[model samples]
Target: MKDPMDLDTPLKPPPAPGSDSPATAAPEARRDRTAPEAQRTDAPKRRSILGRVLAWLVVLALIGGGVWWFAFRPAPEMAARGGPGGFRPGMPTASPVVTATVEKGDMPIRLNGLGTVSSLATVTVRPQVGGQLTQVAFTEGQAVQKGDFLAEVDPRPFQLAVEQAEAQLLRDQALLKNARLDLERYRLLVKQDSIAKQQRDTQESLVQQYEGTVKADQVAVENAKLNLSYTRITAPVSGRAGLRLVDPGNYVTVGEAGGLVVITQVQPISVLFTLPEDNIPAIMARLRDGAHLPVTAYDRTRDRVLATGTLTTVDNQIDVTTGTVKLRAQFDNADQSLFPNQFVNVQLLVDTLAGVPMVPVAAVQRGAPGTYVYVVNGEDSTASVRPVTLGASDGAKTVITKGVQPGETVVIQGADRLREGAKVAATDGAAQPAAPTPSSEGPRPQRRPQRNAS
Candidate 1:
């Protein structure tokens, strides 16, 4: 008999569905069906265990990847190169910047103002006598000198009057001569007792009256000649002539409102400008000392120089509304660079501070520090904040009264990226190998520089 539990051998058919082996066959068939059920259950259990292991492996792999990324990943350079304040716990990076040296030079104190070119003299040419305009002696916009002929009026009428006066003078002279001869005869007859004394006196009186008539005629002739000379007109000043107001062949009068033409002096012109009343004292001081303040005139943009001049005079009173005073400067505009009523920019150089510590105006910075600058240290490639004492600036350079010394390196551009102590790379490459140490000075009020406006 085969062991009931150890059935390695194949089981026989359930006794061919017959009798005699009923109990054993039925138990074997039931055993076979139960075994298949047990096999199916075990298969599902094994598959479930495999699935759980795979899921855990995926979770572990994800966690390890996150750890590696957070702990050992490389950082980008952009994070450190943002600015002077951009940094992390890593190697330091240098910031690119532009630099200028604190130099010792003279800084001119100049005052700027709006100005206009003006003519020293403007005149209107008119006729002294009323008559028909026979000829126009000048072209429109022509330049003329003093006493240059400009126009002419009809002279025939005045000439006729002169001739008539001269003829009357000759006739009066003839009568005076005849009266003198008669008076001579009467005087001689009276002396010889050939005539009455009263008669001789009457003859002398007649001769005197005729002499007076001759003198009156002579005065009339001279007056008529003077009137004839006034027909021609001339320029009163050396200047450029304007358009013709009265054309030739038109009747003009001495009382004409428009006149014949306008003339304006151009060479050696003047510029009129206004300055704040506060500048009067300094300007007056210079003038009282017999010093001629130099003035420069530029175009509207203040880029090109138009002329150089000297301050001539100041207005008697200040304009109360604008709180400014008018000033006149005379320029030798030999090239005719200045025109009447032309707008320009004026710069009056009042004073110059010499041998002062100066730096580019761009190097000056203003912030909570009041006014400051960035001084670079080339030895260690670092920039430090410095509170500077500023004086007057000439728009291009500023004078350093204190807080900075000569022969020092200063950052002119790229200062916005700097801090108290920031590493820098001087693109200028002129940063001194031995830069001066930072000053221990504090911030102070910056002196308001020159006011450059009208």
Candidate 2:
């Protein structure tokens, strides 16, 4: 509630004790003095805050750089040292490996196949005539020769048939004889005019009819004899007999499912095998030249040779489904090593390379480029990779057509650690000469012995 003019007016402090001045000072002077002091104090605070922010930025940059270096660094061993053919420092000097010298030898070209032993002749003996089985003459699993008695049926019935046929033949013969006698008498009667011509003709016809009957009876007798012989069954071939099928007292007939016994010729047996159809051309060429190729049969594991044989024949046609051809080989199984239906592995020697550079099959290794081998340097005992061309292999030795020569050493074992110029030592525990290094000088010369003064 004061006056408006009084509110607008400013107040001032009391004057100093010794001065006599006005009570109020200029307002502009007071504002100017305080503004300058406030600016000075705020300037120092701004500079200190900026310095702390820059220091924090520097620390964060240092931490990010260290994390990147640790995460992306390469392994020590795999990192390149100086250049190619140079290994890292502190690495082992040489790798120990087994080696073999390449040699010139004859290598056989062989074809391997799976086969089954079969008999040249297998017979199932059965009764030709139906009757009760009376006796078995041969034991099971017995070896018998041709015409050996195997079993017998009851021969009494066959014998009775033969006797009946013989009696009928005798009766017809007597009738024929009587008719001939009557014909002779009829001709004599007609010539003497004692009997009519018609009567003589009738008698002649009777004689002819009786002669035909006698001939028919003779054939019956022969047939009956043949049946009698069949009652005593004999082996049609020479072989080892199998288990008896029809025991004594069993009624066996000609139409029985399984025969009485089975006979298989094992002494001179055969094997049936199949080979890839691609090999047929080579095999046929050898056969055409009248060369008797040798075939060997081994057990299922191919560890032991069962028998040696000659290639007997080849099938005319190839199997379409499997792209193979069947071949038969005959063996003189003298030791009875081959048995019927036995599984075996077969090898056929088709051709032989007279002289070829060969090495152990283990020396060959496949890489990205192709097949290669590790060839050891003779002077320095260091290994270098050599790409090679391969030929036929017999599972143990391989024929090297190129990239290797006779008497050159090749690494066969412990080659996993080998590089292009790696040093290698023999694994056989033999003392090996020290590998030549880059700093090694040539062989030192020896001074001649000085002559003694006289």
Candidate 3:
């Protein structure tokens, strides 16, 4: 009977709820009624949210721990990545090291300073006599020996004076001859009583006076010749001549204001420098003790030695303003490197210390006590800063009088980043025998270690 009204499609059968028969409705109502589905869906979703929150919390804790490790730990401990040997398990690795053998030797403490090149014995050459400059024998910049003729002043005036003196001498000689003949006749007449005694005496006196006048004329001739000879200008010392200040025609006044050219002696140049009064005792001790003080001059800008010489003079008094004493050193400047008034770094070696332990200046750290260095221990490779006594210093190297040994490697490269008892993995990883690589040249990229900014 129901099929008669229905189409070919199957018709859903209607159920009665009060008779305990199942019923189907909207999709949402069906889902709400399913117990297993509700519980299965809720359980997985809740577990997923809790897992996401826990994961985020764990990530934050790890980040916070890493930051603490970096900030609070020492450089060595950080370098190890929170473990020994600069390494941590399952972490990025560090470079391994092979050690170098360190040994003891006589370290010469080199004291470095900037200096200048100069020349000595600069002099002003002046014309001795004023005249027309007749000849110039040397060029403006030529080197001349002592007594080399430089120029000739006009000698015509001097020559004319000499001629006049010669002519006067001839006249004077004729007068003297006549007087002598008269004196002879007067003496003979006196013997025979042919003339009075007064007359003979007068003739003899006239002859003597004429002889004195002739002698005076001769001296005048010599004087004229001396002035003529003075007209030629000569070099007083072997030296290099500078530009002629006064040309040949210019008149030159003699004695005080007299100068023709400046002559600088180029060989065996002297360096005049000053040393502090505090250094005088050491300088004198070396000199008196028969230890020759080697004075070395250097060009500061170029950082090269200009000359080396023996110290010659030490001034008597200390300079009030600078608290220094004047000193002079002589050098064989065959190459003409040194000049007068040229400022130079004068290194005076008071004495040499034999077999003194030395270290790079960087290794010496100034602490509470005067000076100290970090001594790396053999057992744990830990370091403790120990106070030291020191002596003379070369700007690059320092003299260690006490405390540390020569063979021990005092950290030069990484010292600025270290502290007491901090474990240090030597980037070079060995005891260094002598001084460190000259970082005065600055850091080289290939061998440069990452500096500890702290």
Candidate 4:
């Protein structure tokens, strides 16, 4: 055992070659060697403990920073938008909008209906007598006047009949003349008592029979002449002829379904249109006053005006199935603008409201508040919702019966997203200027030209 309090410590020599015995050393030498190994092991443990402490400290610092940011920091968007925690609150936002001025104008009330062009007279030409068609005098599609020669049928048969009837009439006339002379002689003989009374009566009866035969022959001759005239066919009405149904050299008969030809009078044409039954009262009232309501016909697209005319008459009864009534309008059609069976759009100027306050239709809005408009105050540059009483609208402009005055500006576009007192930036960027206020002059313009853009 080593001394407990040994002060002198010495180093020990290493083992020699070939020495098998385990090497032994003084207590101090052994202590020095073991002390270095223990010191190395303990150094690593201290370093590991110090590193763990540093890792825990860094994690705690990150958690503290996240808590502060999530709980105490303000949102960037809210700050910029000027909310309670906003960066700016003095500036106000204005909604962009387009505007127009209200003006007093003549608003015409017009009714529109789909109509079809019809001919005043349509005739199907046919033969009155049966015969071979020898000649077609009129060309197809040719405009012919009434009584114009159209076609001719074979006249040889009719002419022969006329000759035979005339010859029979001549023969009967000679016999009748002979009988009359005999009857006169019989009467003279009876008066002189030279013959019996019964003989004179028999002779008189024979004379009457001959006269009746001559009269029958004369009737046959007139009938044959009338049949001959029928061989020359003529137009019954003035119109434009259609395609010929029966060509020359073909046999035709009377009352044939497929007639010789069809003719339509287009010069003074008529249009048949329909209107709702609800409109009958107003139309009848105007008609009773002898008013000739003007009507305009438009093309299929309602883009071009084909012709203009006056309302002529209304149908006597309404069409119950469709709840509509038929109306007829007449046009001179001098230029042949309207054709038979052509579909068209018709506009009837019913009545014109004169000198009424009007505004663009786009300015009108319907919402929780029945009908309203956004009236823009020029001085404050703000928009306000104003309720209005509407009268009539011509698609482009509407009549304001109440709640709006002339010379005031109203928001025509961008009324959405607007509050009662919302600020607005108004711009007058419409295609056409406000319509001209109507004058009590000639007549009210039925429709506003499509040039007015909202």
The residue-level lDDT of candidate 4 at 200 comes to 89
Q: Is candidate 1 or candidate 4 better by TM-score?
A: 4
Any runs in candidate 1 off by more than 4 Å, and if so which?
A: 1-95, 170-218, 377-382, 429-454
> Which residue pairs overlap in candidate 2's backbone?
none
Better of 3 and 4 by lDDT: 4
The parts of candidate 3 lying over 4 Å away from their true place are: 1-120, 170-211, 248-259, 406-409, 416-454
Better of 1 and 2 by TM-score: 2
* Per-model TM-score versus the true fold: 0.67, 0.68, 0.64, 0.68
**Per-residue alpha-carbon lDDT of candidate 4 for residues 1-454, written as tens digits (9 for 90 to 100):** 7885676757567667765445344665778889989999999999999999999999999999999986775322221265565467545567788888899989888888878899999999888889999999898889999999999989999999999999999999999899889889999999999999998899889888988999999999999999999999999998899998988999888776799999999988999999999999988998898888999988776656899999999999989899999999999888888999998888898888999999987899999998999999988998889999998888778899988999899988788767788877788846547557443222332342245454
Residue-level lDDT tens digits of model 1 in 1-454: 8788776978777655456576677888888889989998899999999999999999999999999986775422233544586655555556778888899988777887888899999998878899999999899999999999998899999999999999999999999999999998998998899989999899889899999999999999999998898898889999999999988999999867899999999988999999899999989988999988999888775556899999999999999999999999999999999999998888898887889999877899999988999999878988888899999887567899987899889998888877667788787635436345232111121232447882
Q: Tell me the lDDT of model 3 at 219.
A: 100
Query: In model 1, where is the ten-residue run with the lowest total lDDT?
Result: 439-448
Error of 1 at 174 (Å): 5.7
Cα deviation in Å at residue 63, candidate 2?
A: 18
The C-alpha stretches of model 4 lying farther than 4 A from their native spots are: 1-98, 171-215, 377-382, 423-454
> Compared to the true structure, candidate 3 yields what TM-score?
0.64
What global local distance difference test value does model 2 have?
0.86
